[model samples]
Target: MDKKQAQALGKLLRLSREKAGLSGRELADRSGMAASNVLRLEQGTIANPRPETLKSLADVLDLDLSDLYAAAGYIQPEGLPSFAPYLRSKYSGLPASAQRELETSFAKIAAKHGYDPNGPQPGEDETE
Candidate 1:
């Protein structure tokens, strides 16, 4: 993934860890990783964490592997396919404004369902 994607994923993972009441050091202890490594992962300095490392993290954080991948933009969700695929299937020839409308609609739906496309909920603690 690109640097931006990696950064986004790292942010998401950090949020998830905090929401689950885990501190970076605590997560490291549970996952058998170094605290510095955890910090680097959360900071996107380590863009490509090993699959086994991710698995260990998921196990400690109680997250599904697919969910983690989706957060990283590595894989799309099952029900709501990737935006690229969706656009190609339904509005490949549409104007930019139409695409904007589609994105807006999807954003509304996601927000209504308590999913924040911007990131995790506000006022969330970064360190648990």
Candidate 2:
């Protein structure tokens, strides 16, 4: 990954960790990884992190792996598939309502973060 991409990935990882209300050490423990590994990734020191490592961290962080992959410059965001498929694949054990809630939350957050191209744009009237 380029320097900027690594930095963005690190920022996203830190933000997601904070959003999940977990410290770096806590996330490392839950993910069965070293605390320094998490710290290095969050500090953008790991320019070429392993996919499995990212997957494990994402699983623990309740984050979409594809997002991490995209942030890591492994894939282009425009070519990215809808994230809903990922939720379905990973959370088949979740109750139907819970899966639906995840979908709803994903959509809302995607829109809020300006990543959902199909969602209503800023200042666009949704009631139209």
Candidate 3:
């Protein structure tokens, strides 16, 4: 990651952590990272963190992993299967009420289309 990117990521991490109501030490404990490491990352002292580290932070901070990956300089190939980045870019910034409304609409659409997001996966037994 470049300097600007690192700084941007740090700012995002700090903002997300605060929004999640977690202190740096609390976030580190939840994410399984060292408190000092979290501080360094938040301070932009660590330019590039490992992918797993980023994922852990995202999970703890309730952030989208795709966003972190993009911030850390990972680019998806053209024609790739994932649409998470596009969806996040389009809707992630919406207010909570708007997001909940959209989510309800999407759920209705999925049910109408016979798609059950909670259904068992292909490899799983339908009966639990």
Off by over 4 Å in 3: 80-128
Clashing pairs in 1: none
TM-score of each: 0.54, 0.61, 0.62
lDDT of 3 by residue, 1-128 (tens): 89889888999999999999999999999999999999999888888799999999988988889899898887756654333344445688887677667767777888899876666578776665
Looking at model 3, the pairs that clash are none
Provide the overall lDDT of each model, using Cα atoms, as 2-decimal numbers: 0.79, 0.87, 0.84
TM-score of structure candidate 1 = 0.54
For model 1, residues 51-123, the per-residue Cα lDDT tens digits are 7788789888888876677655565545666664566556868888888788788878887998765465567
The window of 10 residues in a row where model 3 has the poorest summed lDDT is 80-89
C-alpha lDDT (0 to 100) for residue 12 of candidate 3: 95
